[model samples]
Target: MAKSITQEFVKGLWDEIPPFRLVLGLCPVLAVTKSVENGLGMGMAVVFVLVCSNMLVSLLRNIIPSKVRIACFIVIIATFVIVVELLMQAYTYSLFLKLGIFIPLIVVNCVVLGRAEAFAYKNGVVASIADGLGICVGFTLSLTALGALREVFGSGTFLGMSVFGPSFQPFTFMVEAPGAFVCLGLMLCMMNLAGNK
Candidate 1:
């Protein structure tokens, strides 16, 4: 059966969510999510790259040879990633510094490449756009949630504003590598339990 455009768009939000459901892009998810600002920045970059690449891939699906499809996808994805990196550096130098190498690394993110290979190449422009938007929104939500959790518990602040009172002691661990894993694990567990129920 054919799926409606809305279904295609909606599925990526939760059903096939990139990080939490599909678990495709963990590197950026875990790395830049120490703060909501960093997570949102990285998420937007990924969205721009993903949507642009997906659209291009869908547009050229017929012309690109199957044997070199992967290379074509990488080139398309890299172009958008570069654009994102330049834009970030120009407008948000602090975020650009915070994101560091992860910004450029967006070119190699599996989420972008995977969508190109698995969905965009086989779908129409509209559907590809929907897929890209849906996936990126899902990714952004996941990153923001994780970042907020870490920021609140680890730093006693939310997006740099203190959330707890003066006497409230920060956990500190929630901002560390181990904390990221633990938080992600617990979140995943909750997601699983919710889905099962």
Candidate 2:
């Protein structure tokens, strides 16, 4: 059975989202989502790495030995992650600082390596690229939503712009670590409930 390009593209959008569906790449999901800006930056970086790694892995799938495939894939993904990290440092230093260890940590993100080995290795370059793009978008949306929710409730702001005005008292817990878990759990529950409906 052949998988169409559309199938590859759409699957990641909802079916195999890094955080919600697959449950992969949760560390960054919980960490840098303090603000919408940080979440967007991190999501974009992950997308870049996933697309590049998937494309490269698909291209090299035939030649790479099964035994060393994991190492090769990791190296390829890490290279792109580094490129994104350096670019962020050069241009968006403040956002990069907010992202901190999570930026470099993209190298170890299972979603990147998982797609490379699971889909890229077995599919054509076009399909692999489509899959990567879909997954990246899914990840971006989920993270950004979480970030927006947290930022708005925690500090009464959205992306640093005040949303609730001076009268609204901010909830300090919404921006903290515990808030992340609560937000994520609630979001996941909402997503599941929506899907069931």
Q: Among these predicted structures, which one has the highest lDDT?
A: 1
lDDT of candidates 1 onward, in order: 0.92, 0.92
The root-mean-square deviation over C-alpha atoms between each candidate and the true structure, in angstroms, is: 0.8, 0.9
Q: In candidate 2, what are the lDDT values of residues 47-136, reduced to their tens digit? A: 999999999999999999999999999999889988998999999999888889998899999889889988999998999999999999
lDDT score, candidate 2: 0.92
lDDT per residue for candidate 1 within 1-197, as digits (tens), equals 19878998899987999988888889999999999999998999998999999999999999999999999899999898889888988999999999999999998789999999999999999999999999999999999999999999999999899998899899999999999999999999999998988
Best by TM-score: 1
Off by over 4 Å in 1: none
Kindly report which residue pairs in candidate 1 clash with one another.
none
Model 2 stretches with alpha carbons more than 4 Å out: none
